[model samples]
Target: MEWSKITSDKTALSLIAIVFVIFTIEGLFYASFLGEDGIINDVDYTIAEEDAQAHWDEYKAVTVNVDNLRQALDNGNLSLKLLDEDVSIIIFESDKADGYYRGYANGVAANQAEFSFGENAFSCYVDLGTHSYQIAPSWDIVDNKMIYAVYMTDYKKEEQRHEEYPIDPLTFEISNEDNLKHNISIEVFNPSSSLIFSEEYSISPGEVIVSPDISEFLGKHRYVVVLDGDYEFEESATVARSTGLGSSEKLYFNFINNSEYPMEVGIEVA
Candidate 1:
C-alpha cells in the first residue's frame, strides 16, 4: 500500500472511533435523565420535591388559636390540647410506628400560644402537678389540607383521668371489587395512643373481608384506625362512641383498582 494512503486510512479509523465514543456517551447521558416513558425523570423528581416543600411551607404558616380550635372540635375534628404552660408537642410522620421523633412544638402560656404543624401525626405532653400526662391524637389530611386542630383545655389535678373508657364492639368490613390482589394493613390505637392491634391481609378480587371483632378483645369505645394498602381509604379515622340506642356502628370500605399502569385505587366508604 502507498504510504500516504495507509496514513489516511489510519486517520479515518481514528475519527470513526472518536465519533462512536462521543455518540455512546451522549446516549448514556440521555438515558440517565429520561425514563422508559420518555419523560425526564430527574425533572419530575425535582418538581415533586418542590411541590412537597410548598405544602410544608403552607402548613408551617398556619397558627391555631382558641376560637378556630373550638370550631374544629365542634366539626368533629380530632385534637390534643395543652391547658397549661410548659407543655411540649411532638410530631411524627404517619407511616412511622417506632416513634421516630421529628421535631417539637411547645405551648407557651395558655391558649394564646401560637401552634403550627405539618401534615403529620401529633402527640402532646403536659405536666400536671407532679404527674406528666401524654396523649397522641389522630389527624387527617383531606384535599391537600390538614383537617385537625390543637388548643388549650383546662384540667384539674383531681381529674387523674388515665383510665380507658368502655366501648362497644366496632367492626370493619372491606370488600375488594378490583381485579387485582391488594395488601391491606390495619392499625388500631387506643385512647392512650398505644397500638393495641395491628394486622395485615391480602384480599383477592371480588373478595369480602371482615376484621375480627376488634372491640371483643380491645374493648375501647374511642380508638384511632389507620388503614393502608396499595389503594386508599380514609387513611386515619378517630372512631367515637355512637349516640344511637343500638351498638357502635360498623365501617364499610370498598376498594377498586381503576388503572392498570399506575395502579389507581378508588375507595368508597358507606
Candidate 2:
C-alpha cells in the first residue's frame, strides 16, 4: 500500500459504502413493488372500473330496437309513437320518392313508399297510387302533434284538394322576407320535416335560402324557420329576402299537374 496517501479510517469508509448500497436497494424495491405506473391504491382503481361499467350501462339503454324498423315497413306511413324519444327514418326507395318528395307537378298518382328509422330521424316515401315520393320527419317529436311531416303528392289531387299553382320565385320572396335571416334555428316535430326548406346565414341583416332553384328542392320540406333576432323589413327588401323570411303571412305554393293522369296530393308541410 502507498502508506503516504492511505486514509486513516478505512473502517468508516466501508460503513459509508454499505449505507449507500442499502439505500439503492430500498429504492429499487419501492419502485418494483408499486404499480407499473407507480400507483398502488386499491380504492382509486375500483372507482375507474365502476366508471367504465356506468358507460356500458348508458350505451345499452340507448341502443335502438330493430322491431321499430319492422313496424315502419308494416305501416304504409312508417309511423312511430311519440311516447318519449326522438327517432330517425330512412326511405328504401330514394329515387322514386325524390320526384314527389320535391312536390313535382307531374299528374300521376304514386304508391305508398317504405321507410326505416334510426337513432334520431325518420324518413319515408309516399305512394299516391302511381308514384313514390320521399318524406323525412323532423328530428324532434312533440307529444300529440304531427308537425314536421313530409308529404309527397300534388296539392290539387289530395283529400284536401285545393287549387294548385306554380311556386313563383318573386311571390315567395315577398311572403317570407320578414323571418329569413343569416343564422336560423329549426325544430322539427314530424316525419315529414324533411320536406321543409329553410336556411339561415349571418351574411347580412336578413335570412336567405342557400339554394332557391325549384329543381334543387322539389319535395315537401318539414322544418321550422327561426330567425336569430327580431327584424323589421321594408317593401323593397321583400323581393330580395330568402324563402323562409318576410312578413308574417301564410304563403301557399302550388304544384301544376301536367302528367298523363289525375294527380294525388300528399301532405308534408303541415
Candidate 3:
C-alpha cells in the first residue's frame, strides 16, 4: 500500500511539472508574437513618419509663397486710383467673416521715425484679417489731360540745325492745357536711374512748340515734363513717373504752385 501511494504521488508531481513548462512556453510565444511586435510592426514606420513630416512642411512653404505671389500680381497689374478719401481691402478671406481691411493716402510726411514713410508719397493699406499689417507703395498719377508732342534733343554748338545731330530726336509731347506755364523743363531717364538730360525752356501760352533740337532725347528712355502752372480745369496735377517692374522709382507731380506767381522747375533722375 505504501509503495502504490508513493508511485501515485510521484506521477501526479510529474504531470504538474509538464503543465507548468507548457504554460511558460505559451506565455513567451504570446509576448513575442502578439504583444511586442503586433502593435507597430514595420521597421520603416519611423522613417515614413519623418518623410511625411518633411513633405507637409514643404507643402506649407509652397502655400505661403503662392499667397505672396498672388498679392504681388494683384498690386502690379491693377493700378488703384484713390479718388475717394479712403479705400478698403476686404480681409474676411471669404465674405463670411467680420474683419475688415482699411487703406488711405494718409498724407505724406518726412520719415524721421521708424514705420514712417521717408519723404515719400505712398498709397497705404492695412490687412486686418490674418495680420494687422500695413501696405504702402509709391503713388502714381492718372487724370484727364490732352496729349501733346514735345521734342527733346542734344544740341551741338558747332551745328546750328536739327539735321546735324546723330541720335534721333525724341518727339512725344504730354498734353495738359490746364498746366499752362511760362517756363517748362523736360527730362528723360533710363531704367538704370541715369538722367539722360535735363533742360530748361520757356513757351508762349496756348503754344505747342516742337523742340527744334529733338534728336537727342529719343531712345529707349522714359521722359518727364515739369511745367510751372496748375492745370486749367483741375486744381490738382497728375504725374506719371518711372516706368518699371514695380514702379519702385516712381514719383508723381506734388508741386502745386501755392505761390502767387509761377514756380521754377527742375528735373531729377532716381
Counting clashing residue pairs in each candidate, in order, gives 0, 58, 14
Query: What is the C-alpha lDDT profile of model 1 across 130-206, one tens digit per residue?
Result: 33333333233223332221222224322322123233455676677668776667666543345566777777888
- Clash pairs (backbone) in predicted model 1: none
Write down the lDDT of every candidate, Cα atoms only.
Answer: 0.35, 0.26, 0.26
Q: Is 1 or 2 the stronger prediction by TM-score? A: 1
Name the runs in model 3 displaced over 4 angstroms: 1-168, 173-181, 212-219, 229-270
Q: What tens digits encode model 2's per-residue C-alpha lDDT throughout 116-179? A: 3444444544344433344343232223211122223433343222122223232222112222
In candidate 1, how many clashes are counted? Answer: 0
Give residue 146's error in model 1 in angstroms: 10
Candidate 3 lDDT score at position 203: 55
Error of 1 at 253 (Å): 2.3
- Quote each prediction's TM-score: 0.34, 0.26, 0.21
Tell me which of candidates 1 and 2 scores higher on lDDT: 1
Ranking by lDDT: 1, 2, 3
